[model samples]
Target: MDLPIETTRLRLTELTLTDLADYENLIMIPEISVGAGFNLVSNPKMLGAVARRQVTAPNSFGIRVKGRLVGAILLHEQVGFDYQPDHANLELSYFLHPDWWHQGIMSEALIKLIEELTASKTIKTLNAEVFSSNQASKGVLKKAGFQKKTTLIDPLVSKEKVIYQRALR
Candidate 1:
C-alpha cells in the first residue's frame, strides 16, 4: 500500500536497480536460494537479469537493515485456493541472509508489512507456504498471527510444505 514502510530496525522499500549487487549477493547464498526454491545462478549476466526482474516486480520489497539490503519479501497472487471471486488474496514469500537469521528482524518486518496491507483494505487474506523443515519460518508466521491451514508436498520444490494463512477481515 505504501512504499518504504519502516519499523524500529528495518526499512521495507520497493526494490530498485541500485540494490542489484546486494540482491545478487544475498540471493546467491545456497541456504537462502535453495530454501526459497531458486535455482543457483552462476552466470553474472543471468543473475543481473534476475535481479532486474525482482526490482521491477510488483509488490516486491527489499528488506534493508542500516541501509544495506539483507533480505526480501514478495507478495503475489495466491494459487490452489478457493474463495469468493471478489475477495483479494495473496501469497507471501521471503528470504533473509543467514547472518540475520534468528534475530527477530524478519518477524518485525513481516508484522509491519501486515499492518500496512491490512490497513489499506485492499487485501482480504494473506498466505505463506514454508517447508515443513523450516521451523524458524514457521515461528515467524505464527508470531505474525498466521495459522496453519494445510500441509502438502510442494510440486515445484518437492518438499512437504505447511500452508499458513492470516485473514485481514
Candidate 2:
C-alpha cells in the first residue's frame, strides 16, 4: 500500500480519495477511455463511484505530473489468467490524459516502475493485455522490454487484446 515510483517528469503513487475530481476529469475524456477500456462517466455521481473504486483497488496508482493526477498505472496479480507455468503473473496497465500523450511521460514512468518492481523481487513476470488498436500502448510496452506473446479476442471488450510479457527475475 505504500508504493511510490518516481521518474524525472512523473510520479506513480497510490490513488487517494481526495483525487476524485482530478481522476474523474482525466478519465471522462472519451478518447482516453476508449483505449483504456470503459466509457466516459455520464454524471458526477457515477464519477464519484468510479473514483472510489479506483482509490480502493489494491495495486492501482495515480500518475502525477507537476503535482496533479493526470493519469493512472496499475499492476494486478492475475488469479485465473492462463499464465505461463514457470512464473506468477502481474498485469500492467496504464493510461494518460490526451493532453499528455506523445510526450513520453508514460514511457518514462513505466520504465522506472519496471526497474523498481523488478528490484523489489516481488514480481516474477509482468504481463500486459493491450487493445490491438492501441499502438501507443504497444510501443510503450515494447520500449520497456516487453515481448509480444500472443493475440486473443477479449470477449468482455469485444476486441483483440495483444498479450505482452517481460520477466522480472
Candidate 3:
C-alpha cells in the first residue's frame, strides 16, 4: 500500500530498512513500547525483519512529521488481548521520540490515519490499550476520537495495560 497520507502537520507512509535510523530512538526505547505490549529494540536486525514483514502486513504505517520519520501508527487486525474483529475494526498502536511530544504531531497523524482508513473502508472501529499510568498516550488517543471502553487489567499484557476503543462508523 502506497499510503503517502498527509495532513497539515503529519504524514503516513510505508517504511523500509532505510527507516531504521529514523525510528531507532522510539522503537528502541523501553518506555515507549513498554506500555504498548510490544518492544522492538534488543536487536536492530530483528526490528528490520519485523519492519520488512510489516511492509506486506497491510495493517501498519510509519508516522512522519515534515518528511522526517518520528514514529509509527498501526491498525492491527488481531491481538492477543482480544481475538476480536468488527469486520473492519482495527487496534491503535503508536510510539514516538520524546522530541516530538506535545507538538500534536500524533494527534494530527491519528486523525489523518482514521480518515484515510475510513475512506479506504479499512476499518470502522479502532481499539487501544494504554497503560493506566501513561497519561500522555491516553491524551493522544482521546484526541484521535477513541473513547474509554474499559479499564480492566489485561491478563495477557499484565496489569499495566488498560483497554480503550473507538468506533469509526
Best by TM-score: 1
Model 2 lDDT vs. the true structure?
0.81
Tens digits of lDDT, candidate 1, 1-169? 7688998899999987788778888877899878875665667788778778877788889999999899999887755445434337888899999999999999999999999998999888998999999999999999999999999998876789999999987
All candidates: CA RMSD in angstroms?
2.8, 3.4, 3.4
TM-score, candidate 1, is: 0.88
Between prediction 1 and prediction 3, the one with superior TM-score is: 1
| lDDT for predicted candidate 1 compared with the true structure | 0.88
Q: Write the per-residue lDDT of candidate 3 for residues 96-115, one digit (tens) a residue.
A: 77788888888888888777
Model 1 residue-pair collision total: 0
Q: Which candidate has the highest lDDT of all?
A: 1
Indicate the residue-level lDDT of 32 in model 2. 74
- Model 2: per-residue lDDT, tens digit, 30-103? 88767766464557677678767877787778889999888888777777545543235678878899889989
Score residue 64 of candidate 2 by CA lDDT: 93
lDDT of 3: 0.72
Question: Worst lDDT window (10 residues) for model 1?
Answer: 78-87
Query: What are the TM-scores, per candidate, against the unseen true structure?
Result: 0.88, 0.85, 0.79
